[model samples]
Target: MARKPTSPADEVLLAAARARSSTVTATQLERWRGAGLLPRNVTRSLGRGRGSTSAPADGVVDLVVWLAQHARPGRRPHDLALHAFGEGLAVPEPTVRAAWRASVQRVVLSGERDLPAPADGEDRTDWAWDVAERAAANAASVVLPRRMRRIDERLAAAGVSWAPSELTQYDRGPAGEEPVTARDFATFAAAGVLAGAPELTGPAMAPHVRALLPVGAVSPVASWLEYPDEPGRDPAEINDGAGLSLLPIGDVREDLLRVIDEAEPHQLRAAWRAAAEMREWALEHCGAVEAELDAGELGDATLAWMMGAILGLPRLLVRQALLDRRPSISTQVSTAVMVLWIGVSLHRLRRLMPDGQYELLPALLPPFLHPLAGIPLKPVGEAAADDAVG
Candidate 1:
C-alpha cells in the first residue's frame, strides 16, 4: 500500500512535541520522516510560513526516546535543532529542559542505556532496566561510604585515645588501625613491602637520599665519605660505592630522572642529588619486574595505578616549587614517574586481558574499582587466561 505524505504543519507540530517529551530536534524529525521512521501523514501544516509545519504528538514522543538512546557522545544530535521552531504546543524552555534531564536519567544515567528493545510495543524495557541498574549502583555506593566512614572514625578515635609514636614503645596497634605508612609512599614501601623505603628518615634523609644509598644497607648515612665531618664519626672514609648504585624497588628514584630531565640547570643538580638515594633503591628492587609479577605478590594493576598516582604528585610539586622561584628540582621528574606507572598498568592490563581484547578490563574494573559498582553484563572476574590464551 502507498503511504500518504505528511503535511508541513504536522511536521512542525511533531518537532515541538518531540522536543517537549524527549530531546529530538526538528531537523532530526525531518530526517526520520524522510527515512520512513515516522508515518508520512504524522506531520501537519497550519500556516503559510516555514515554521508552520510540525510533527504529530505520538511521533514526537517516540522519536525523542529513540534519539536519546542512540545519541553519540561528544557530538550534538540533530534533534537539538528543533529549538528553532517557536510555534506548536508552546512548551516552556525550563519545562522541556527538565523533561529532557528526566528522560536522560531514565535512559542513560541509570546505566541501562545499552539494552535491546523490540520495534513494536512496550516502551518500558530500557526504562525499567535503567531503574534497576541505577538502584543497584546506588545501593552499593551508599553502603560503601558508610562502611568507610565508620572505619575512619574508629581509627581516629583509637589514635586520639592511645597515641604512641613508635611500635617499639607501644604495646599493640589500636583497634582497627590502618598502617600509617600507606599514607606516605616512601614509608609504606620501606615499612610494609619495599626494601629501601623505610630508612628515608630524619635530617640525614635528604643528604643520604642525595648520596644514592643501597637498598638494604643498614645505617646507609654512616657509609658515606662525607660522614667523617659529622660529630661522632671517625676520620675513616667509606667505600660502599656499589651499594649506592643499585636502586631499591618502590623508591621515588625514577621521579628524580624526570626532574633532571625537565629542570633548568640551576635546579637540575640539586634535584638529581635529591633523587640519588631513591633512584638507587628503585633500580634494585623494582628492576626484577618479571620475577615479582610471576610470584603474584605484586599486582600489575595495583603497581601501575600506584605508579601513575606517585608520578602525578611530583609533576605538580616540581611546578609549584619552580613557581616559588626555587629551581633546585628537575621539571621532567614527573615524566619518568608517569612512564613507569603506565608500564606497570599496561603490564597488568595485558595480564587481565591476555587475548588483547577489552572484554575483561572495561567490564571488570568499573564494577570492582568504582565506588558505584554494578552487576557486570559478563563474568569479568572469571579466569580470563583460559578463554584468551588457552
Candidate 2:
C-alpha cells in the first residue's frame, strides 16, 4: 500500500519542532531555518554502551543551535550577530554562506550601535572592484597590437562575454601590441592554442609569452631570445641590455669612431628548434631541469642551458613546420623544457657560447645553419681555442 505523502510542514518543519520540544509552530521553525539559524541536518543517535541513554553533547550541533539562538537577537548589534554566525560554522557553500553571513553581519553592523569588536572590517565592496579593474588594465596594457583580433576571437571562442569597458581596460596599453589578459591567457591555455598564436611566432619575441602558460613544448622564438653568443657580448647583456663594450662608439658620417653594441647573438634556425624541444621536455617532467643541471648528470655545466634550449627549439620549428601539415609525434610537448633547462643555466653562467660575441646575432641566422652556427660541441679545455669559438 502507498503511504500518504508527507505534509509540506512535516518535510522541513518536523525536525526543528522535535529538536526544540515541539513548542514552536512549524511555520516558526521554517522561518528560523530559512534565516540560517537552524542546522540543515540534525542526526540523532542513541548513546552507545551506556546504562542510561543520556542526551550527548554534539560539538557541531551545539555550535549550530547556539548560532541560531543568538541570531539577530533583539538589542544585539547587527554586525556582531553576523560575525558570530560565521565563527560558528565551517560552511563550504560560498553563495549560501555569504548571503546568510551578510544578513547576520548587516544587523550587527547597523548604524549608531556598538557591539563586541569585529575581527576584520568588512564594508569595502568597492575595494574588490578596484582590484579587478586594475588587474584588467594591467592585462590589457601588455597585449600586443597585432594580436588584437586573435585575442578577441580567443575570448569569443571561449564563450567569455566581457563588457566593452572591461575589454578595453584589459587590452589598454601603448599603441603597439596589446598585452593578453590573464583571463584570456587562461582561456587560450584551456584550448591548447597558446603555442600557435601569431605573437608567439617568428625567431624572436618577448620572454613573457613563453612564461605565460606552462606549455608542454617551447618555441624556437624562446630559444632565440635566450641565445648565447661570441666576443665582447655576454648573453645576459643581450636580452637585459647591460654589458661593458669595447668597440669604437661613432656616427658613420663623422670621422669619429663608434663602439656599436649589440645583443648577444644566438643562432635561431639551428638552436631554436632543438632548444624548443628541450624546453617542452623540461616543462613536462618537472625535475628535468634539475636533472640536466645536476653536477653528475650532463657534467659540463656550461652545456646545460644551450642543450636545454635545443630541446625546445624544435617546438618553434614544428609550429611553423606543421602549419602546412600535421606531425605524428611532434615534440611540441613538455619534454622540450629539458632543453631550455640546459639553455637557460648555461646562458646564466655565460659559458654556453663564445665570449665577447653577441648571442642575438647568431639567433638571427637561418634555421638551416643550426648544425653549423653554434660554438664547437667539445668541452671547454678539450676543443682548440680558435675552433671552440663560434
Candidate 3:
C-alpha cells in the first residue's frame, strides 16, 4: 500500500530540524529524547481516536545534531547532558550536575569492585583506588573555581570587562577555526594544566589536528602556514608574512614541524590517546561553566575562572602529556599534533573578540617571551606611567 503524503506542517517541522545539519535522523532524535538530552515534541490532537503528530521543539534539532557530532559509545549519559549544556542548550544546570555526580559515584563504586586480585608483593591496587578517590574529590572541589580564577586573571590582565551578560555572549571566533601550536602546548604543559601521565597521550589528537586545517591543507607545512580569512579579507591574500608572524603558533612552527617529522608509530598511538583526553576534559569543563552560567550563578570570579580554563587547560594537558617523559618518536609527533590543537583553539578564542578588542586588551596576547616579536612592541612601563599621570 502507498503511504499517505506528509502534511505541510510536518514538512516544515522536518526542515526546521535539519537546518543546522543535513544528517539528523528519526532514530537519533528519539534516542536523544529518551536520554533526556533533548525535550519531547509538542503534539496536536487529530480528534477521534487517531494518533497525534508533533514537531520537534525549537532548538532541539540543533542540539541533537551537535550532540550527535560529539557522541561516542560507552560515554556516560551525564557527560552527554553536560556536553549539551556546555554547547549552550537550555538544559537546567542542577539537573545535569546532579546526573554527572551520580554517574561518577557509580563509576567509583564499580571501579572498586572491578579491581583484580593482587599478585604477591602487589598490594598497590587498593592504594591506587584510594589515590583515585582522593584525586576525584580534589578535582570536584577545585576544578570549577580554578578554571574561573584563571579566566579572571587573563581578562583582568587584558583589561577586558567582566559583565556576566557580555561574557556569556563573548565570541569564540569563527566556528571552524581553532588555533593550535607547539610552543603554547609546551608552555601549558610546563605550567601543569591537566597533570597526567607523561607516557600517555590524549585520545583525540589526530582528529583535533585535522579539524584545525582547511580542506586540502592537510600537509604539515600547509596547515601551519594557512590562515583562515578574516572578515573583509580575501582568503588568498590573508597569509602575508607579517600577518602570519602575528599568530602565537607561528613562532612555534619550526618546533612543531620537527616533532611531526620524527614521530614513531607506537608514540603516535600514545599521542592520540593524550589528545582525545584533553579534548574531552575541555568539553567537560566548558559544560560545567555553561551550566553555572545558565543558573545565573556565574559571578565575575567564576566567569574569570571559566575563561582561564577555556584558554589554558588544553595546552596544560597536551604539554604535560608530551613532556612528562623522555621524548620518543610517538610522543614527539603527538606533542606536535597536540600543540597544533591547543594553538588552534587558542587562536579561535582570541579571534572571538571584536577585532580591536584583542589589541586593546594586551593581556590577550600569546604568552611569548618576546611578546612583541610579531606585533609591534610597546613599552608597558611607559603606558602604565602615562595612565598613572592621566
Candidate 4:
C-alpha cells in the first residue's frame, strides 16, 4: 500500500536534524539522494490538491552527515557508492559493485584510446598533448591496483566477502624497476626479444674502452648508438677520432646502431603497442590479484611478484621514452608520474607485508647504472694519464 505523503513541515524537521547532527547543505542532500546513497524525499499534496513540497525521509539527515564525514575529497562517484554499500547504507552490493567496476573500466578504456600517437616531428603542441594524455593514462593505471586493494579493505572492514562472477589468473610477473646488474639487463633484453622488439641488443663495451672512457663520454655513446645515422656520420669515426678507443667494440656497436637507425620507425611503433599491451595486461592482472586475495589464493610471494611487475612498468616506459630521440614529452612526464604513484603504492604495500617478505625482483635497472651496459669503470691511474694528455 502507498504511504501518506509528508508535509512541508517535514522539511523544517529535516533542517532541524541537519543542524543538530551534521553540516550538510541542501545541495548535498539532493546529490546523495540522486546518487542513491540516500532515500528520496517524500512529497505531500495540500488539502486543496495544490502543489507539493518534498521532505527527506526520517534519519536521512543524520545519515547524510555521517557519509559526509567519511567521504574524502576527489573520490570518484563509484568509490563513494561502494563506501555507502560497505557501510550498510541500504544500496545493493551487486549494484554498487557493478557500477564501480563499470566506471573503472570506462576510465581505463578512455585512457587506452586517448593515448597519443607518435608525433610527426618536434611538434611541441602535439607532443605536449600526447604527454598529458600519457601521464593521465599512466596515473590511471597506477591507481587501478590501489583501488582494487581498497575494495578488499572496505569489504573486509564491513565483514563482507563475495566472489566475482569470473575467476582467472594472468601471470606476468612484477613490471617495474630492477637492480643495476648485468644479469638483470640480460633479462630485459630477453623480454624485448620476446616482445618482438628489434634486435637492439649487442655485446657490452670492451673492458679497456670501459676503463679508458670517462663516464660522460660513455653516456653519449649509448644515446648516439640509438640514432647513429641521425648525424649522417660514421659512429666509428666519431668514437675513434674522439680517442675513446671504442674501436675494439666498434663492430658490435655498429651492428646495434644499425639496427636502431634502420628500424627506428618500426621500433617506435612497437614500443607504443608494447606499452599499451602492458598497461592493459597490468590492469587485468590487478583485478585477478584482487579476486585471488579475496579467495586466499594469493600468497606473499605472488603478491610481491605482482607488485614488482607494477613497479617495473614505469621504468620500462621511461626507458622507451628516452630511447626515442624525438620522444613524446607527454610520455616522459606520464612515466615520471607513474613512477611516483608506483613508489607510493609500493610503500603502502610494504607496510602491510611482513618484514623482509617482499623483495623487488632484480631486472631492468636503469641503463646508465646497469653494470654491463653502464659506463665502464676507470682504473686508478688512468685519470692521471688522460689529465696529462689534456
Estimate the TM-score for candidate 4. 0.25
Error of 3 at 373 (Å): 38
Candidate 4 C-alpha lDDT tens digits along 137-181: 323222123343464364445443222122112211112222223
How big is the positional error of residue 60 in model 3, measured in Å on the Cα after superposition?
A: 1.7
Q: Which stretches of candidate 2 lie over 4 Å from their true place?
A: 1-179, 182-285, 288-327, 330-356, 359-372, 379-390
Q: Model 2: number of clashes?
A: 99
Clashes of each: 44, 99, 35, 12
- The C-alpha lDDT values of all candidates are 0.33, 0.33, 0.42, 0.39
Worst 10 residues of 3 by lDDT: 191-200
Candidate 4 wrongly placed segments (more than 4 Å): 1-20, 34-36, 43-62, 71-73, 91-98, 106-111, 114-390
Candidate 3 on 1-390: residue-level lDDT in tens?
865565544455457657756565555655665777667666788889897877756766566667657767887666676556544565434445354334323333222355532453245434443434433432322212344344335444444443335433432222244554433233232212111222112222322333322222222212222333254232222233444422222113333443334444333333334444544444455456456555656555344443443343333453244333454333333443654434443344455433534553344322321121123456899879877986
What TM-score fits each model?
0.16, 0.19, 0.27, 0.25
lDDT of 4 at 215: 19
Q: Highest TM-score among the candidates is held by which one?
A: 3
Error of 2 at 281 (Å): 5.6
Could you give the candidate ranking by TM-score, starting with the highest? Answer: 3, 4, 2, 1
Candidate 4, 62: how far from true, in Å? 4.8
- Best of the two (1, 2) by lDDT: 2
Estimate the lDDT of model 4. Answer: 0.39
